[model samples]
Target: MNIALPALVVFALLLPGFIARSRIKRAERSSLDYSPFGQIVTEAVLWAGGLHLLWLALAALFFGRHVQPTLLLGLMVSDAAAQARSISNLASELSWIAAYFGSLFAFAYGAPALIRAAIIRWRLDRAGAPLSPLLRFHAAPWYYLLTGADFPPGEEPDCIVVSAIVNISGRPWIYMGILDDFFLDPEGRLDRMVLEKVMRRPLDADKQPSTQADEELARFYVVDGDYFVLRYAETVTLNVEYIKLRPAA
Candidate 1:
């Protein structure tokens, strides 16, 4: 019974973290890399020590004068010695239960906020810029690309930006205007983009204004005056050459 109780307590204490790790692994697939061995060892020690201290504090609070550190110390000593005592009679059992459930509850409540904070910190670290409110829920790769740090001169951009050629259903069309907004899938890939002040010109039309033409298009050619949503999957190609043109005086 003593062996069983301590084993159960240990499992309960670690279960929340184990479940979190599993969920992160599943979510990130192989993209998540393992920490260094030294860092892993350090974190393991810190977690074990912190949990043990928390358990001790709970024991002192619950069992008070009856709580004996010797019982807990022996429980940690060896399997044989741990099995020697009857866990049911131990004054600290209630404290163990409280600590176990308390840890689980804390993790459940705080994990989402913690994850958000971590992601924000990581994005800031990688992009070397403050995170935009627009990207609070988006992921790293998207943030990096949007910040223009990932794009260099003469290179194909990772994302479709201001003005571009958007091929939809094999029909080539010129898309003009600001890329005002975008959405990301759970895995952080761009799902859809919203363009504002949008105008479209057929690829074969010679009357089309030069990309640098700042004059407003005739109302007839304006596809969407306010906004248009372009799905990433539906877009066959995006030519960013127009983005290099200087606006007409």
Candidate 2:
């Protein structure tokens, strides 16, 4: 009985850690070349500590006191009958506690993830929002992970284009330009982006264009007259990878 209870506890503690390690492995499968030893150890320690605390809390709350330490000591030194009795009692107590608190833990982890997934789905499904083909897959959620200052609704700040990679005519092209303005459809969804004073780098480019070398391509493309209109649909992939509002000079 003592051996069984300790084994159960050990299994419970390690299950979460194992699941976490599997998820990390899946996420880093493409880019990471080396084993993440530090991350693995950190996650294992964190899961073990968190589960221990949960178990302790459940025991204290339901049983009116902590019992594992005493039970473990008894198991180690007690006689056969005494050890058997202690193990049976401890197993019975933990079974009830695990049944109740395990459900609570599952709900706590699941609810938030479901809520966030719903929110991201709603935003992406809205009409006129910039749609990416990648959004049809698991990568959709990554679109919301934009790095920028928080711009509240109905407030248009002076947004500057730092750099952009645009796929045009079945070929990838990089452009360096200044963001002038943006247009939204009737539903207040982003429709078109206008970039002014644009300079196009060479086709099939892998590296960022040198601003000094491309001085000739630097010319003002007037808004509503000659500015580049990115309609969001014409490209295979569009990433606003970086943006910084150029301060007024």
Candidate 3:
């Protein structure tokens, strides 16, 4: 009965903002770890679907419904149907309830992302500069063999800048985040499972040369998550890329 109509409208209104926030977060998170694009997409879809269904159910309750259509049917068969006129009124009331619930659900899921995106987009565009191209590379599977050298020492930058130059120029490359802490084995060699996932192919490394343009970017600071600190380094270099082993001290 066109139940999705209002929900679709609300999603349309709210999607742009979420898209913006999603984009910036993706870029920022890309520095530390390979971006979790698939996971993000799945979460967003599930959130929207759950909210939509819940709202539809609420709207049905808000609008009045036909509790006893059979009474009118019986009266009609007996040539005493005088209350059939109320059927249209009941249907109309039910529709209003459905619409209300759909609108409410749409707003709940969409509002925050939209507002966050608006701010992000403003800061990004007003700076009048472009971010450098993302660097990427593939780490071979065998690098995970080094057992003890897995962790990097001290506070690392939010985006680990690897210095590996790609063989192919102008490819759509991105700085895949650090491969550290990925293989933590909570239950039986969890680290090994993660290592297998990342080792599926070559990982990405950042190789952009420092430039005046980077200096002007306000959003490019390296943030430290563990210590709650922001370390604004002009340039942090990785001597090797695609190695699962920790960097040489």
Which model scores highest in TM-score? 1
- The residue-by-residue lDDT of candidate 2 on 1-249, one tens digit each, is 345655565566566555433332312124332446886667666755665577668767986756467666556653667677666777767766576457645644554356445534454433234642322223223223231222333322444553455676667665655566655454334556677766665454434454664444443222344578776444444555344356589
Candidate 3: stretches off by over 4 Å: 1-37, 64-106, 109-231, 235-249
Ranking by TM-score: 1, 2, 3
Better of 2 and 3 by TM-score: 2
Q: List the residue pairs that clash in candidate 1.
A: none
- Ten-residue region with minimum lDDT total, candidate 2: 134-143
In model 2, the runs with Cα more than 4 Å from the true position are: 1-8, 17-35, 58-65, 70-87, 104-146, 149-173, 176-249
In lDDT terms, how accurate is model 3?
A: 0.36
Candidate 2: what lDDT?
0.51
Clashes of 2: 0
- How many residue pairs clash in model 3? 16
TM-score computed on alpha carbons, candidate 2: 0.40
TM values, all candidates:
0.52, 0.40, 0.23
Worst 10 residues of 3 by lDDT: 193-202
lDDT of 3 by residue, 1-249 (tens): 333443554565345334433433323122243437776556456555655455555545775432355543433342323334444444655665455545654566466456545643433222122421211111212222222222233322333223222222444222222334333222222232111111111223224443565442322334334222111121122233434335689
- Tens digits of per-residue lDDT, candidate 1, 15-48, equal 5544444332212223443556675455444554
